[model samples]
Every structure is written in structure tokens, then in C-alpha cells.
Target: MTNFLPMTKDDMSKRGWDQLDFLFVSGDAYVDHPSFGPAIICRLLEKSGYKVGIIAQPDWRSTNDFKRLGKPKLGILVSAGNLDSMLNKYTAAKKYRSTDNYSPGGQAGLRPERATIVYCNRIREIWKHTPLIIGGIEGSLRRFAHYDYWSDSVRRSILVDSRADLLIYGMGEKQIKEVAAQLSAGISIENIRDIAGTCYRTETLEHLWDYIEIPSYQDVVNSKKDFANAFKFQYLEQDPIRGKTLAQGHGEQFVVQNQPAMPLTTPEMDEIYDLPYQRTYHPSYTAAGGIPAIQEVKFSIVSHRGCYGSCSFCALYAHQGRIIQARSTESILREAQEIVKMPDFKGYIHDVGGPTANFRQPACEHQMDRGTCRGKQCLFPNACKSLDTSHTEYLQLLREIRKIPGVKKVFVRSGLRYDYLMAANDMEFLRELCEHHVSGQLKVAPEHISPKVTKLMGKAGKETYLKFKKAYEKVNKDLGKEQYLVPYFMSSHPGSGLKEAIEMAEFLRDTGYNPEQVQDFIPTPGSLSTCMYYTGINPLTEEKVYVAKTPHDKRLQRALLQYRNPKNYELVREALVKAGRQDLIGYEAKCLIRPPRNKQNIAVSQPENWNKKRRLAPSRTQHSKTKQTRKI
Candidate 1:
């Protein structure tokens, strides 16, 4: 076992302490989720003989937390996945800033300004010369210039905003390992530009800064002209080669460098999944008194990595890659055995799924050869002809898992790819999956009703969703079970303004299903959808689209998904009014319209108005007195 000193201020002040072999800062909560990308990276660094300490959910109250970790002998590894400061703050801000979600008790509160960026900047301030390497979903997705929904404007690359030494996009296991090894051997961060999966700014590039010249916060505050220019600059993506050339042209500006994308190796993924994780809820946050032992565990395992769905509003494909990589059945079974050995091992194994539970391998055989896939998408309106529909091996693996002792139920709670499901020639495997794995409901993503919006999102059309829904129902009826499909939907995506959103609402109403939850479109960095959100054009096709630019409009589109709520009634009414969509406001227009409220009834109460008048009168008197005193 590798021996390491405990992390503390005292230990950090020691002679050799100036140089930490490794330091891991996670944007996620300390508790390990199956999708804890940062935790896995930290463990990998530990395994490689690095002294690693984690700063989880960093407190930006001061720079002390960053300083306490001490200067790393190598550098800092920052991951903002599973828990991103920006996403966390944005969610909070949305709740607090909205009049509808607000509570009298101040239930929703203001978030700290620029939470993620500020936290990173503070760390840089503390360790002035230390290399700060930013990765994970937040960094990877926002590596380039893109639209920021929270700020309602285009923003600079995350590297510039975070002031990090380097930014790594996509999965960072291999890239980080290489960076650590190189830095430990006395290589400078500047010399490591050739490494794939990294982005950095350099002074040498010419014209590189021309398009990327964003106004400083003060500059924007001081002049509207500077702010507008910065907004335009924010939407641009610099040509990588030209950016490098421009850096060389400009002697003063540092050359911006980017490494090619690096993918994780099979062995590395296997090693990460095999970590000794206590996969229960954090003891402090859980309602249950104690941490549940491994014996009480029923089933747990991740099936694959990455997604190919390419939903425009989704950030998963950006960070995890669109390629699907699965571990062999033998390796997965080994994990199952470990869970079965736990003292409280239950007969049920709760989860065995990944991004899309049904997608076990790459859609095309070219992926095996590391060749470019000519296929536009794995999940088009229908399954790709090249897709391997065979599930014999997968079925056999499930059978083997069931034979294991202490295993009762093996559940697949992850959302399934219905498009892929409907294409299968044989439904036997799917029937078996339902019979053994499903716990009454199978979740799937049928993001929108309109084909136009669906095409923009690179997802299957409404017909596909309906076809799968019908097939699923038939299967359930045949089995004499009441299993249901819980379909996931997204509102206010880049191409989905009020019109498309209303169409989705109408579709939901017609189906007689009011979804319990709906995901609002968050234009995270590095996604194809994010590009559309930023530029108002599809990156691939370069087609212009109607983007919901205003915050209120976006909110209205999101509210349409929750048609059951009366508060949403005002939202729908306002949206229709603003869009001049009077045709949809009537009682029976074949549209999903919210009922109008009496305007007079909603006026401020007499007592509340009187209280406001009383408060303002005193403030006015105080102001008059202060002015008279100053004059005297």
C-alpha cells in the first residue's frame, strides 16, 4: 500500500510540502455516485503513487480552502461534473429569480456570483504560479466560446474565464495521467501543448485574439459599446490551426494551443469501475440513521460509457463522447460477485445500466477499427442499418448473473433507446429484459413531438416514439402485466420556441399523460446543440433557427411542459400574448392552452398597498432631512 500523510495545514507547511505530487479538486459532492467522474480520476492518481487530497464542493467563502490544499508539486486537477458550480448556481438562480417559484420564507436564495469561475480564480490567486488543470463536464463542454443561458449572452472559453493553466475536453483519465507524468518529470506546462484533450492561450498567436477579444467585466459595466462587442465575440469559434498561426504572428499574446481529443482506454475504464466504493447515500444527508453495509445491497453495475443520441440540449455526449464502450460480461460478473458477498446482500440488484440501457455496443462496425463513422447518427428516425441488433451475448450474460447466489432482482432503471428497441428483428430478448429486469416502468427519451425539432436535436421523430410506445404496450398486455413506459421530454431546446413547445404540450395532453418531471434545455458547452443555441444556426447544416432568446420566453416554454400547475397558467397566457398567438388562447382550439385568471382578483391587496405606502413615507422623510442637514 502507498503511504501518504494526512491532509492538514501543518503537513502542508513541511519542507517537501511546497510540491504536492497531486491535488484533486472536485466540483461534485464527496459522496461517490456511479457517475462520479472526478472521484474516479482522483483514485487513478492515487494508484499511480501520487499524494492526492480532494477539495469537494469547494467553499468560495475564502481562498483558504484552496490554500489549505497547498501548492501541488505537479498541478491541480479540477473536475466539475456530477456537481458543477455553474449548474448548481444556475439552478438556484432560476428558482430565486423567478416570481412563480418564490416562497414567502425565502425558500429560494440568491447564488454566489460566478460561482465556478470565481472559485477557480480564487484558487489561481492563492497558488499564483501553480498549474491549474480544469476538466470534467463543466470544463470540457465550455472549452470553447458558447452561449451562457444564465447570463443570456455568449461567453469566452472556460480556460479564459476560469484562468486555468490548461483545459481538457472530453474524458480526461488518459490525458490527466499523461499530464501528471510529464509534469512530475520536470516538463513545463508550456512544453506540454502537444498533448491531446487540452486547450490553452498563448501570446504568440496573431488574429487569434482578434475574434476572441472579450471586454473585461469592468469594461462591459463602464460602456454599453464594449459589452455589445464582447457579446458578438462570445459567439465565435476560432479556427484551431489559424488560432495557432495567429499566436505565432503576435509576439506579445500567448499562443492558444489545443490538443487532439483523447479517449479512455478499456483497461483504464475497467480499473475505475473496480474501485472500492461504498455506493450508498451519504450518511449525513440520508434520512436513514447509518450507512448501509454492502450486504443490504441488491444489485449495482454500470453497463457502458458514452452516448450516441446527440440530443442538442444534452451535455452527456460532449463530455463522455458519442462512442459506446462496454466491459466484457466476465468483468461485470466479477463486480456482481463482490456485491453478493456483502453481509446484507439482498436478492434484488437495483441497477445495471448506463447512458442508454439498451445500447450495449457501437452502432457501426467501423468503430472497432477506429475509423470515421459515415453514419449520421446511431439513432435516426429509425435504427442505423449498420447497427448490430444481436443481443445473444447480452442475454446470456444476464442469465449467468441471475444464477449467482444472493441475487434476486436485476433492474434496468436507466432510460432505454426506444428507436433501437423497435428496430430489432426479434423481440425475444426485449421480452426477457422486461420479464426479468423492469420494475414496472421503463424510462425512455422522446424529447419532442415536432419532427422539425426532433431533427434539430438529432433524435427520432414522434412516429418513432409512438411506434415504440404501442409495441411496449402490446408486450405488456401479452404478458398480463401493467408495465408502463415513462417518457422523458425536454422543453425550450435551441430550435423549440413557443410554437414547438405548445405542440409538445398538445401532444402530451392528447396522450392523457402529464409527465411528473421535465428537463429544461440547458445549453452546456461542447455540445452540437450548444453551438446552435449560441450562433442561432446548426453547426453541421448551417441552418438558421428561431431561438428563445429572452429569459421570460424560455421560462414560458419550460412551464408549458407542466400543464397541471395553475401557476403555469399565467406563464402560458403571457407567452401566447407576447407571441400574438391568440388562436391558441380559446377553450377548444385543439391546443394545450392554460385557463386565464381574473386580472382584477390578482391585484395587490389593500392592506399590502397601505403597508408599502407607510414604509415609503418614512424613507422619503428621512431623505428630506438628510438633504436639509447637508445644505445647512
Candidate 2:
């Protein structure tokens, strides 16, 4: 029978089972949609001839909630929800956010900080021998010893803190399959250390082969130089084709990560997403307004996974990897047909894309056999000659979805890499994109326009965005459509300073763009930019980079993005004067902000004070595959 995995003891009883083979514990409320990681993992296990039940957002104050399903026959899988717990609970400014989109009714405080550790510790107090496995964004990104921005220190790998028997780094289906099979065959969790994309801790590294050793946890904590070096080593070796096993010492023990699992093939992607997902939050959550995060993705089709954009601030490179694995056109159409039958679907199909919507294949021919050219990016500084910039497959997929019966408008909400589209040999994708796919405004991420800052961000040059903008305008002009392009901008990245901030403000002024969506960089762990933010050195170049560390600098940079706003007038005026661009403070049409009308001082609200006003956790403002925290 197609149903939600057991969430309560009575659910198991109804399923005619006294115990489950695996107990899945997630920090988010259980929403059995394929988009949610916990649901995917549990559903995948169920399809593989194993029994799995989810214990979503359990109360960690006591072990009772953890014990509701009793000890699993084989193991327990832990995840910190779709988004990381800390990032889910707080805003970029490090203030308590009142809403958690993953929680039921958008409630807060259901999960504790560092949820994996707390949950695992609670599980251990009762069932010490049951195998514990941790994965998902929080555990995967923190699989190594890395910097923690909230604590202002380098913490050990999550494996050490959670005491999990194993850590699966990437999207963990392949690793989980192997572990489950081994466990089912009477293999112990202690001996299941050699699987690809899995991490295990040991007192010795003698059993490992073809491995590289990174800086020990102590070295990273003590020396910023070592910290940069350690991050650089791990950054370049993320490819499955060329990546090697990595070992890092933490005190007398070591955390060893095997080579990443191979990217899922088209058939594999089809099956995983096709699993019988209930496609909504549990029925038990109906009264509290259900999960807010599922609203966007419930009717949306995830056409693909992974990205190669290599934006410095994004963790997709670390989590989903660069390889593009997409579902077959038939599979996507099948899902679309299913959505058409849903009770609440309406006629509009919310989205039909994933990561980079336009990306339908690997960046180049060599990626499948030789891996991504080690440190070089396919779309950075300039588009690589070997890069394949075709949108033919994706455009056809969209056309087919539009043809589906009872479907009206289909929008491409996933980010479209404009630089890639601009570099393509065909203009049909851009033309068709503007005419058919756009829903009035197409959102693109042009994080920064400053050459130096863009260079550090691993983004295309300003010329690319400019050229694409003209093309988009021309396309909409020919189609007689008045569509708009909403460009997402970020402030206070590692390489951005007052000079760069003033330049962005000037670009906004000249372009007449008053950004409602602004991303102030939050240095989350497991990203190259976070490494630079901590050590003041770009891991890629090993050269010194300017980091805006102080609250004063962050305020000025963020305020500059919205210079025309009345609330940001003081900060913007002060920034212009600090940059020696006092000419921009006058009443001229080109000036970013006008001189104060009256000398009377006005109190402006800071981020901490402003977050006090309750708000839902906003959608993706940062340049990440995962929807991470942004300014409230």
C-alpha cells in the first residue's frame, strides 16, 4: 500500500509490524514529499525491501520521543532536516528567527541547536548498541573539521560530536544501500568503513588505501594558514572520478572520508524521485497549517540535481557535486501528469526545474570520464571552450510539460545561469524562455558586478550579465511581452570592501534597481567563501583577501545595496563619505542618497532589533542550491 512511513507506534501496529528495520530521525517535521531529504531516505529504504519509520523533530529533552518506535532491528538514520538546524533557527545576522519553514505551522524551537549531536546523544543514553548514521546538509557539510561562524571557532567533524557509526556525505542513497545490504547480511556497522561517500572514525589509518591526509583538527584550530590549506585540499578533490579518500586527525582519532559516490545516472535519478512519495506533509500536521517549506515544492517537479556554477558562496559544490544528473523526459512528464490530478494543484505548475534550470547535461564531455578540470570552473573568468552550452533538452522538456492536459502556466523558478545562456550558440532558448517560461519576472543571481569581487566569487564577469540583459530585453521586445528580470545581489562577501560596496551602489543607481531581495553573506561551514571569511585568505589562490568582519563594516555594505531606502539613508551617506565619494550625498538625480532633509537625528532599527518582528523564514536569497538563511 502507498502510505507515509510510520510516525507513531500505532502506525507500525497498523502496518502489521512490531519493529522496524530502520528508524529515521529528522529535525524537520515529517513531510513525505520527494523534495524533503528524510522522506526520500525513508522511502528509498522502504523500496529496497527494508522497513523504515520516521520520528520527525522529536523532543530531545528526554529519550521518550526517541524511544517511540523502539530500537530498529538494523540502524537509525539522522538528519538535521532539509536545511541545516542552526541556519534554519537563526538569520544571517545571528538573531533568533521566529519561524522555521521546515517546522509545522512555521513554528520555531522544535529542534535544538546542533540537532544531530543532541539526538544521537539522547539515543545513546537508551540504546547504546543500535547503529547510528548521520547525513543530510548539516552532517554532510560538517563531515570534516571546519570553521563554525556562530561559535567563532573550528569545531571537530560532526562524526566526533554525534558519535555516529558512519557519516554519509553527499545525497546518501548509494551509501545507504550498501550499508543496509551489509547490515542485513550480518555485517557489523564497525566494519562498514570502506564504502564510497561514507565517513568513519578510527584510531588508526593503516587499513586505508589511495588516501590523502589533511591538516589535523588541532592544526586547523591553531593556525589559519593550515586552515586555508586544509580547505583547499578538500575543495579540489570533490569529483567522484578523480577524488581520493581524505583523512583528518582529531586528537588521537581520525575522521576518514572515502571517495564520493558516483553521481546518479538518468535511470537512477528517475527511480529515486519516482518512489511513492505521499507528496505532502503528514496528515497529522493538518491542524497547525502543515509545513511551510512543502508549499513551494509540492506541485513543483525537480527536473534535475547538482550544479557546476561553482559560486564561491554556495555549498552545492560540496554537497550535490558538480555533475548534473537529471530525470528522463518521460519521468518528468509522468510526475506532471500526477500533479494535474491533485486536489489543490490548480492550473498553474509552480516550477519545472532544479539547481540550474537550464542545465540538462554535464558541463563538458570530459566530466563523465575525466572529472571536472581540477580547479578550473566551466563558467567563471570565461566560459571554457569544451563547455557544452545547449538548452535544447531542457527547452523540449518544458515544452512537453506545457502541453500536458489541464496545465496552464509553467514557470522556471529555479535559477537560470544567464552567463551560460549568453555563451550558448543558439538564441532560441533565451527567446523561448522569455516568451513561454517567464512569469512576469525572471530571477537571476548576479551576486556582484565588481570585477575583483566577481573574480573571487567564481562568477562570470559583469559583461556577461550586461550582454544577457540586452538579449533578454530584445527577446521580450520581439515577443511583445513586458517581462522583467529580478537580479539577486549579495553584500559583504570575502573580497568586497567599502570601495566595492560603493561600486555596487553606483551600479544599482545607474541601473535604477531598488533591490527587495538582498543577501548579506553568512559564512556557513563547508564553503570556500567561509574559509576565506575565517582566514582572510582565498583558498583557491592562497592570496590574501579582504574580509568585512566587524558589524560596522557589514552594516555599511548591506545598507549600500538599498541606498535609496529612507531607513538606510544614514548608513549609505556615511558609506559614501567613508569611500571619499561625498559627491554622491547630494540631491542630484544620479546620487545614491540625498543629504538629510533635517539635521534631527532619527533612530534606525538594527538587524537584531528588526528580527524581533515575527516573519517566516524567507526563501533562497543566497547563492546556494540549498535554500539557506538570509536577512529577515
Candidate 3:
């Protein structure tokens, strides 16, 4: 049931076929989200018959929308807007910073790297020799050679700076429909090195280059800061012809392929969530006034894909494989009744959840024929004596999508694995997920409260986030209201520093809660927390610790988790007086600590140098001399 190749728009003006066997090209904007992983590899290469077309956010104002799909037998897939903008260009250089500090209600800004290297050199100047295939989550978490955090160094290998001919890393729907059915059967880009979550670039040594297996771009150019420990260090099981080999050798003697990374069939996730969504917004972001598409149109729905809470600053259990794979709850209520027949259905659907949305299933049941369960601790971290924690079909699929009918509210807004909801056997499903899917704040991440930095970020401790914040404040004080939990904390992870971010800013000043948004550990790219943020230790427990590893002490331990900013009170008062913690300095530190008063409101809002206040006003010397003479 996988043979697709049907081009439309009157079959490309009845066969003068201006290049399309597949094209896509995105950075996100084709009514983004819930059509993820590059809109399911462009609807699985238009259902396997390839002749696709898409250019979502392209138009570098002439390069004719990357040459209006006109030079394509096969070339171009690209995707940079999910999985944290495909492998970190430090969230696309903090969205090309001219200051908007990571999505302050985003405005489709930040495109730099010279506008993504001039939109990949104008789509290779209108497809010269086609093929560009870069793959999502910021080109598969910056495929090979890491650390760029807005060019702070060690770059190269986003497939040789996006010149891209191949790079289809992680969860690419059957490696982009088997590289668009071997480039629409004509093959040859040196025969796509037998495609399997591809990453090409070679000149020889072919153990199947024409059939595809030429990986070893000089062991990712001599182990570029150990490309995610050389792709999870070796795990081959199938590569006689491409698909599943998950890493091999080069640098620090690599080897993690004990076989297990592949899971995307539920009719390839319901034919990539039945494509063609016009959830809308992106006529160059509604003509640059941006930041509105009904506030980034996210009626999203996924439910599950993979993650069994490995969390060493996660890469979703190494790119989707801690095994979960959900979808059918009548395919998430027919994609939440087609996002309430979208004309921007804003009765709030926004997010249902995935990756950790109360983990829908597959922690084991020989995970659909013996694929994952080689278990290594994760049954609510110490409760897995054959764990079940009964989510009861994810709380009966969020109570049948809050009984459908123009659903007005149903957000789990992702990130909720609170030790699998404090190993739920029913706190009445967290009081029916806080009386019908909270929107009046519920977030939860508990990223660190310092049980030795949540066991070096794999997590579970600080009494399991103070027992899920006293069972979400005793189910919001017996549903008497005033619901709140937002939590989420992380600062310089890699065995945290400044005494575990001042013991997590004194456990958020003794749990009154301070987080006015904090997250500073950005080591991204196939995480194990960016190999303990570039080898401060713990590449699988080689331990060692104390690493705020600079970036001005990881921005003063992420401004001590928003100690109510006065530009983070003189860098958390010189990191709490160089960690002797001068009793958390100045304001009796009970927590939401905002004192240095934005450096006394930037020295009382500047602008007062009218000739240095008329040369320190009063020419004092003359006045003093006159007074002295009078006294004499």
C-alpha cells in the first residue's frame, strides 16, 4: 500500500513538468505544527509516487520561490522548525538576535547565517544538479560537528554548511519514503549511498555507495566533538542495503548499535496525519507584521511518538525510540475533529501532547514485536517492578477529547511526565486533569531541584519535585480553584554549578515559586545533554561534576532562575558572593528576589549628561575660595 506519484495543479501544466519529484523546503510556515517532521516527509513523498511541491517560508524575494518547483526529478526536503529548530543554531541564533530573547511571543524573525546561507545559496541557484534533502529538527540536530550556539565556535557539517545532498536523520518517515523511491527510479547522486536515515558526502570506499551505505564522511570529519558520541556509538543490524545501523566508529572508540531504532508505522502515522492542512498564516508571515496566525496557530495533536523518560537533557530518547508510538484513539478523535474544522478554530486546542504526554503506551509489550524494552531504569524511576501506572488509555483519551463539539479547551501543553504523573493509579486522573485540561496554568517540568541536580539531569528526586508539588497543591485545594504549577527549571545543566544553581535558588525560595521563565542549558543536538555539555563528564556515568562551564557562568546560572530581574540583580549578586552565598544577599532572599533594581533602573534611566550636568554644576572651586576669603 505504498506506491505514490501523482502531481497536480493540472499535473504540472500537463507534463512540461517544471521540476518536482519532490521539493518541500521549509523553516516552518505551512500552517505549522501537528504536521511535523517535515510534514511527515512531505506526505510520505506524496504517498510514494513523488512529484511533490512546497516552499513554505522561502521566497528570498526572487530566486523565484526557489525556482517555482521547476528543476526536480528529486531534490530538496529541508525542515528547520521542530525538535528545537532542527539541531540548534542556538534556536536559529536566538532567532537571529537583534534582541527577542527566544520567542518572546515570536515574530518570525531571526533567519541569519546570512539568511540561512542565502537560503541555501538560492536553492543551489535554482537547482543545479538538484538534490538538497536536509531533514528536520534543525537538520537532524545539527548532523555532525556540534557547538555553534550562535557561532560561539566549532561549526561545519550541517552537511557541509547546508550544501545538502542528503541528511535525513531521526524519525524521517521511512527515511523519506526510501529517498523518494530511489529518486523517482532514475537514481544517481552517486546512487544516494543506499539511504537509511541518510548523511551523504563521499569520494570513495564504497560498501554500497550506489545502493547506499557510504556513511563515514571521514567518521564525521574526525569525530567533530564526538558527534553525539559518534551517533550513539555503533549499533548496526541492517545496512546491506540501507535503513537501521544507528552509528559506528571514530573517536573515543564508538559502538552503540545493539539494535533498536525504528518505529513509524501506523500507516506511516496515518499517512502523515492526513496532509493538506491550511491551518493558515505565512504569506511571509502575513506580510511581516508577523506574530499572529491566531498567536502561532497551534491546534496541534500528536499524542505520542517516543520517550520513556531518559532525560539526560533529552533528545527524545535519542531521536524517538524510547518507544511509545501512539495515534489511534480513533486517530486522536479524527485529528480532534479536523482541528474543529479550522478557520482558525480558537476554542483553544493548542496542544494535546507527546514525547511525554503521560506516555500513552509502549514502555513494554515487547514494543510491537521486540524492538525497545531493553529497559534501563524508568518505571517512575524506582517503581517498575513491571510498571503500569494506569493512565487507563491516557485518561480515556482525555475524556473523549472533552466531548468534542467545537472543543473550547483541551491543552496538556506538552512536557508532563511528572514521574508519570506521580505514578498515577488515579488521583482521579489528577482530578480529571485539573478539572478538564488546564489552561489557567499547569506546565510542569521540574527539571531540577537538585537531588544532585536531579541525578545529573536524568531526573527523579528533590522528593520527586516535592511530590508533584504536594499533588498539585492537593488538587488545587480540593478543586476550590486557584490552580497553578508552571514549575520548569534548568540552569547550566551538566552537573550544575554555582552550588547546583544555589541549590536551585533555595528551592525557588522555599517553594513560593519564582520562575518568570528560565531554561538556559541549550546544549542540543542528539542529546545526552550535549555529551554532558561538552565533556564536563557523564558520557554514560564517567561522573565527575561541577560545570557551569562558562558563557559567563551559564548566564549566572540562568539568572538564578529569574530572581525577579534587575538584570538579574548584579548577576545574582556576584553569584551569591562567589558561593559563600552571603545569606542569599540584600533582600531577605525568600526567593522571587528582584533587588538590584535593573541596576537602579539603569542608573536612573541615563540620558543626563548635559555637559556633565554643566561641569558638575556650580564651579565649586570659585565658590569655595570666595567663602574662605570671607571667613578669613
Distance from true position, residue 339, model 2, in Å?
Answer: 0.5
Candidate with top lDDT is 2
Best by TM-score: 2
Q: On residues 440-503, what C-alpha lDDT tens digit does candidate 1 reach at each position? A: 7776778788888998888888888898788778878888877767677787777887778878
Q: What value of lDDT does candidate 1 attain over all alpha carbons?
A: 0.62
Segments of candidate 3 deviating more than 4 angstroms = 1-46, 50-167, 170-178, 188-190, 193-198, 201-272, 276-335, 339-408, 415-441, 444-481, 489-492, 495-498, 512-525, 537-632
> How good is model 1 by TM-score?
0.77
**In model 2, what is the error at residue 419, expressed in angstroms?**
0.2
Q: Give the runs in model 1 whose Cα sits over 4 Å from its true position.
A: 1-19, 32-34, 96-116, 205-262, 278-299, 343-345, 368-370, 555-632
- Residue 7 displacement in candidate 1 (angstroms): 4.7
Task: Show pairs that collide, candidate 2.
Answer: none
Model 2 quality (TM-score): 0.94
